[model samples]
Target chain A: MDLWVTEYQTPSLGFSCKISETLRVEQTKYQHLAVVNTDQFGKMLLLDGMIQTTEVDEFVYHEMITMVAINSHPNPKNVLIIGGGDGGTLREVVHHPLVENGTLVEIDDRVIQASKDFFPQLSLSFNNPKANVIVDDGIKFVKQHKDKFDVVIIDSTEPVGPAIQLFSKEFYTDVYNCLKADGIIIAQSESPFFNKDVIKMAYSGINNVFNTTKLYLASIPTYPSGLWSFTIGSKKHDPEKVVFSGDLDLKYYTSAIHQAAFMLPNFVKNIIT
Target chain B: MDLWVTEYQTPSLGFSCKISETLRVEQTKYQHLAVVNTDQFGKMLLLDGMIQTTEVDEFVYHEMITMVAINSHPNPKNVLIIGGGDGGTLREVVHHPLVENGTLVEIDDRVIQASKDFFPQLSLSFNNPKANVIVDDGIKFVKQHKDKFDVVIIDSTEPVGPAIQLFSKEFYTDVYNCLKADGIIIAQSESPFFNKDVIKMAYSGINNVFNTTKLYLASIPTYPSGLWSFTIGSKKHDPEKVVFSGDLDLKYYTSAIHQAAFMLPNFVKNIIT
Candidate 1:
C-alpha cells in the first residue's frame, strides 16, 4: 500500500509527498494539523492540508524569515514571534547572542505539542531559557505589549481562517505600536507567483503603518510556490542596509544573501508597488 | 469530472495541475511530449513526464537563461541554443538588438511543432528573420561548428535519455571550441534542491572548460523546486559584470538582478564548491 499526502496548493495545483507513516493527525481548536514521516523530506507538518514545514527544508524558511529581521535591526535584544508554533523561528532568534529574550505567541497549543512530540529538531528551542513559548492569540498579545520588542517576526500561515486578521492593516498598526522606536517587523508574505493579492494586501497594510516597507524573497520548496516573499516594515532602519555586522553559523542567510533578497525582480516589484 | 495531470518530481514527491484538456500527447522520436492546458498556469508542455515550460512562467526561465549571457558579453551577435525547441529562448535571444543571428538546435521537431500549434507566444520567434531553427542533435552540431558563436545557451531538459550527452564534459569541451575567444555559455542547471548531483556534474564539467564559471538562480514555479539554477561558463567576460546597457522591456532580468542572481546561498555554494 502506498500513502501520499497531497496539499492542493491551488484548486488546480497540488504538491504530494509519499509518506511512510502518518505520525499524528488531530483537529485542534483552531485548524486541522497532521504530522507525517515522508521518504523524501523526512518528517513533515501540515495544517489544514497545507504544508507548514518539512525537516529537510525548514532551515531556509526559518533562517530567511528570522535572520533577515533579526540582523537588520541595530540591537535586537527583545524579539516576538507571532504564530511560530513549530519553534523554528524561535530557534533562529535565540541563536543570535544579541537577542536577550525571544517570546513566541501561538494560538494553537496542539501544534506546539505536536512539534514537541514529533519535531524535536525544531521544538528543542522550546526548552531554552531565552525562549518563552506562549499559547494565546497573537493579535491580543501584540495589542497588550506596547513598545517592548526590537523586532516582531510574523511567522503565520496563509491569510485564511485564524491568519486572516494577521494580514490586515489594523493588525500591522498594532504590531507597529508594539515595537520600539526603531523596531522592525518581518512577515512571511505569500508567493509572488501564487498569492499576488495576499502580497499586495500585506505590503499595502505594512507600508501604511511602518516608516519603511520592503519586500524580499526566499525559495522554500514546500510552500505554495517554491518562491516565497517576506515583507519587512521597519520603523527607522532600512532592511536593505545591514545594521548588524555580526555573523551566525547559518545554512542560508548571508550578508550577500541579505542584500540579494531585497533586490526584487521587476515583475514582483510591479505586484507590491 | 476532475481531470488532473501530475508529474512525479521524485518517486516520493509529485506536482499536479488540473487540466481542462490535454492539448497534445505523442511519443516523439526522442521523447514523449504533451501539451496541457492548465487552469492555473495556462498551457504547459511536458516531455517524458517532466514539465518543459508553461505559458505563464516560461518568461522567467527564458529571460533568465538568455538575457544574463547576452548582456554579460561585450557583443553578443551570433547565438546558439541547444535543445530549446519551444522557441522561448530563441524569442528572448532574437529580442536583443545586438543579436544579429540566433540559431536553435533541437533534436526533436515535434516539440517545435507543438509549441507552434499551442504556444504562439513562444513559437512566434520562429518567424523572426534573425532566428535560424535547425532540427538536429545539438552535440553533433556543436562538434561541427568552431569559433562561430558569441553565446551558447543550453536549454536542455534534465540529464536523461537524449540530454545525457548535453551534460557531459566532452560536450562542453566541444562547445568551448565552438565559441569565439570571448564567448559565453549558459545552461539551465537543474534545481539545487532536487538535482544536486546533476548541478555538481554540470558545474564541474563547465568549470573545467571555462575561464570564469558561475552558478545563478531564478524562481521557476513549474519546475521541480520553484527555485531553479542556471550555470554560466564564460571564456573572458565575468557574468557578474553587465556589459550591455541597452534594455529590453523584460519582466524578470535586470542589471541588479544579473548581479543578484549570482549571489548563491551558502548551502547552494556548498553544493558546487
Candidate 2:
C-alpha cells in the first residue's frame, strides 16, 4: 500500500497534520493517534490499537448515552460516569449545573491520561468540582454501591478487550441496582451503524429490565459511517417527555435537541423498534 | 489491504442493507448498482460509485443545514438553494408555508436523477407547486440574477473536484449580488477540526463581500470531522440577531437550537476572532 501522508492545517491550530493512506497520525505527548481514511466512513479516529470513534461520527453515541437517560430522571443530584475514559460523555454531563456530583468509574488510568495529554478540550470537563474520579472496574464498583447515584452513564469503550463485561446483561442489571428510584441508565453500546446486532441484543437486554427504552443519534466525524446511536433505559421517567429545567449552555445539547435527539431517523427507528 | 464491511439492518425497510466495510458485497440491484461495505462510514447508500446519504442517517445533515439558517432568517419569502441536487434542502424549505417560491439550481443532473430514484422520501419535495427545479451552474445563475432572492442557501458538497469553484471568492460576491437588502446567505463551510484552513479562507472571503458574517457549527457524521461549520453572510440583518418567525413543527429546528447552533466551540471561536 502506498503510504500517502498529507498534513492538514487548521487555522486555529497552527501546525499542519497528516492524513496517510493507512492512518492520519496526530502526534501528541501521550501517543501517536491514527485516523484511517475508510471507503465507508470518510475518516475514523483511533488511539493505540483501540477504536476511539469512527469516521461516520460518534458525537451522537457520546451525547445520547450521557444525556437522554440521565436527563430523563428529574433532579439528578448525584451522577456517575463509568469507563468514559475519553471524557466526551463527561463533558456533556458537566454542562448540567444540577449535577451536583459526577463520579467517573474508569479502570484504565492510561486512557484518561492519554486523552488529557492529546485531547485537552474534551478532558477539561474532569476539572469541574462536580466531578469525582474513581479509576476502577465499573462492574465491581457498581455492585458495592446501593442506590447512591441518581444516574449512571456507562461510557465504556466496547464489548471487546477489557470492556467485554460492560456489554453483558449482568452489567445492565447491576447498573439498574446502582441507581435510585426514578433513576436512569445510559450505556455506550457499540455503533448502531456498524454493530447493530450487538446494539439490538443490548437494546433488548436493557429493555427487559427498564420500562422505557429508546435510541437516538449524534454525528461524530471519527466514528464508523458517521452515524452513531445510543440506547436509553429508565425505571420511572418516560424517556420522551422529561421536563429539562436546568440548562448547561451546551454547543450541541438543547431542549429542542433533547427532543429531536429521540426522533430517530427512519432507518434507525425501523431496526430496533 | 484488508477489506472490512459493516451493516445496519433496517427492519422497517425490510432489507438488512450492507452499510460500512467489515461486511462484503450484500446485494446488487442492477448492473451498475452494488451495495459495498466500508470500515469508516458504516453502511453507505451508493449508486454506481457516488454516495447518497447512508441508509442509517441523512436527516441530521439535511435538518442541520436547512433548519438552523431558515429559522434564523425572519420570514423566508423568496428562497434560492444552490447545488442541493438531493432535494433534501428543498424538502425542508417547502415545509415553511411562508416561502413563496423556492428555486433549486443544481449543476449535476446525475445527482438529481440518483436522489430521485433512490431517495423517494427526499424527492417527494420537488412535487410541491412551490418548488421550481432548474439544471444550471449555480455560480453563473447567481451572477445573472440580481437582487431577487430573500434567503440563499449554498448547500454544495466538498471544495474538491467540481465543487472547487463554489468556494471561490467571485461566487460569494455573486451570491451577495443575488440577494435582496434584508436577504442572507448560508454556506456549509468545511469542518473546524480538520478543514480549518479552508474554513478560515471561506470566512475571510465571505466577509470581504458581506458586512455581517457569523460562523456556526453542526455535528455531521459523513463529513471529515464530526465538527462541521456553516458561514452565514447578510446584507442588512445581523447574523447574531436575525429573528425567525416560521413554525413548521420541525423535529430538530427550534428556538433553542437556533441559539445553540450559533455557539462556536471554544477551539473554533479562538481562531476566527
Candidate 3:
C-alpha cells in the first residue's frame, strides 16, 4: 500500500510526497492542520491542504524572508513576525546580533502547539530570551503598535482564506505605520508561475504603501510550483543597495544571492508589474 | 472519470498534470514516448515516464542551452547539437546571426516526428535552411568527426537507457576533441537537489577535460524541483567573462541574467563541486 499526501497546486496540477506515517491531524479554530513524516523531506506541515513548510527546504524560504529584511536595515533592533506559527521566521530573525528583541504574532495557538510538538528544531527559537510569542490576529496587533519595530516580516500562508486580508493596501498601510523610519518589511508573495495574479496584486499593493518596493525569488520544493516570490517594501532604504554587515553563518543567504534574487526573469517581470 | 499523468520525480515525490487527452503514446526504438495536452501547460512530452519538455517552459531550457554558448564564443560559425530531436535547441541556435551551419544528431526519429506533429512551435526550426537533421547515435557521430565544430550542445534526456553514455568522461573527451580551438560545450546537468550525485559527476567529468568549466541555473516549472542546472565546458573562453552580444527578443534571458545565472546559491555551489 502507498501512503501519499497530495496538494492540488491548481485545479489541473498536483504535487505529492510519500509519507511514512501520519503524525497528527486536527482542525484548529483557524484551519485544518496536519503534520506528517515523509520519506524524503523528514517532517511536513500542511494547512488547508496547502503545504506550509517542510523540514528539508524550509531554510530557503525562512532565510529569504527574514535575513534579507534583517540585513536590509542598518541597525535592526526589534523584529516582528506575523503568522509564522512554526517559528521558522523567528529562528532566522534572531541570527542578527543587533536584534535586541523579536516578537511573533500568530492567531492560532494550536499551530504553535503542534509545531512545538512535531518540529522541535524550528520551534526551539520560541524559548529564546529575546523572543516573545503572542496569540492574536496580526493586523489588529500591528494597528495597536506604532513605530515600534525595526523590521516587520509577514510569513503568512497563501491568500485564500485567513490570509486574504493580509495582502490588502489597508493591511500594508497599517504595517507601514507600525515600522520606524527606514524600517523594512518583507512578505511572502506566491509563485509567479502558479499565482501570477496574486503576485501582481502583491507587487502593486506593496508599491502603493511603501516608498521603495522590490521583489525577490527563492526555490521551495514543497510549495505549489517550487518557485516562490517575496516582496519587500522599504520606507527609505533600498534593499538592492544595502550592504551586508551581519555575521550570520548562513547556509543559503549570501551577499551575491541578495542582489541576484531581485534580478527577475523577463516573463516574471512582465507579470509582476 | 479523470485521468492524470504523473512523473515520479523521485521515489518519494510526484508531480502530476491533468490532461485533456492523450494525443499519442508509443514504445519507440529507443524509449517510451507520450504526448499529452495539458489544461494549463498546453502540450507536454514524456520519455520513460519522465517529462522531457513542456510546451510552456521549453523556451527557458532551449534558450539557456544555446544562446549562452552562442554569446560566449566570439565567433561561432559551425555548431552541433546531440540528441535534441524536438529541434528546440536548433531553434534557439539558428537565432544567432553568426552561425553558418548547424547539425542535430538524434538516435530516435520517432521523438522528432512526434514533436513535428504535436509541437509545431518547437519543431518548425527543423526546416531551416541552415539545419541538417541526421538520425544516428551521437557518440559515434562525434567520434568520427574531430576538430569539426565550434560549439557542441548535449541536449539529451537524463542518464538512463541509451543516453547514459553521454554523461561519461570518455564522451566529454570525445566532445573536447570534436570542437575547434577555443570552442565551448554545454550540457544539461540535472537538479542539484534531487540529482546531486549526477550533477557532481558531470561537474568533475567536464572540469577534467576543459580549461574553464562552470555550472549555471534556471527555474523550469515542469521539472523535478523547478530548479535546473547546466554545465558549460570551455576550451579557453571563460563563460563568465564573455559578454552577451545577441539582440534576440527573449522572454527570460537577459544581459544581466547571463552573468547572474552563474551566481548560484551557496547550497548549490557546495553541491556542484
Q: Model 2, A1-273: lDDT tens per residue? A: 433222211111111112334534555444455655544334445654455753333454555566666566778888888877777778777767677888888777666765675565568888888788888778999999988888888776556655677767888888888888777887766555557776787788889887788776665544444446677788888876757776655444555566755655344555687
- Candidate 1 lDDT by residue in tens digits, A1-273: 999999999989989999999999999989999999999899999999999999999999999999888888879999999999999999999989889999999999999999999998899899899999999999999999999999999999989976999999889999999999999999999999989999999999999999999999999999987999999999999888877787787888998999999888899999976
Docking class of 3: high
Ordered from best to worst DockQ, the candidate numbers read 1, 3, 2
List the DockQ of the predictions in order: 0.90, 0.12, 0.81
TM-score: which candidate is best?
A: 1
Residue-level lDDT for B7 in candidate 3: 94
- Interface-residue RMSD per candidate? 0.6, 12.9, 1.0
Worst 10-residue lDDT window for candidate 3 chain A reads A241-250
lDDT of 2 by residue, B1-273 (tens): 443221211111011222334322233322133334433433454433334455335666677677666666777788999988778889888877677888999876666765676567778888899999998989889999998998899987667666778888999989988998888888888777667777887888888999888887665544444457888888877765537664556544555555656755345665577
Best by lDDT: 1
Q: Per-residue lDDT for A75-152 in model 3, tens only?
A: 889999999999998888876788889999999999999889999878989989889999999999999999999899
**2 versus 3: better TM-score goes to:** 3
Clash count list over all predictions? 0, 37, 0
* Model 3: how far residue B16 lies from native, Å: 1.1
Candidate 3 lDDT over residue span B66-111, tens digit each? 8788888888889999998998999888877889888999999999
Alpha carbon lDDT at B101, candidate 2: 84
For candidate 3, the per-residue lDDT at B203 reads: 90
User: Given candidate 2, what's the lDDT at residue A215?
Assistant: 74
Kindly report which residue pairs in candidate 3 clash with one another: none
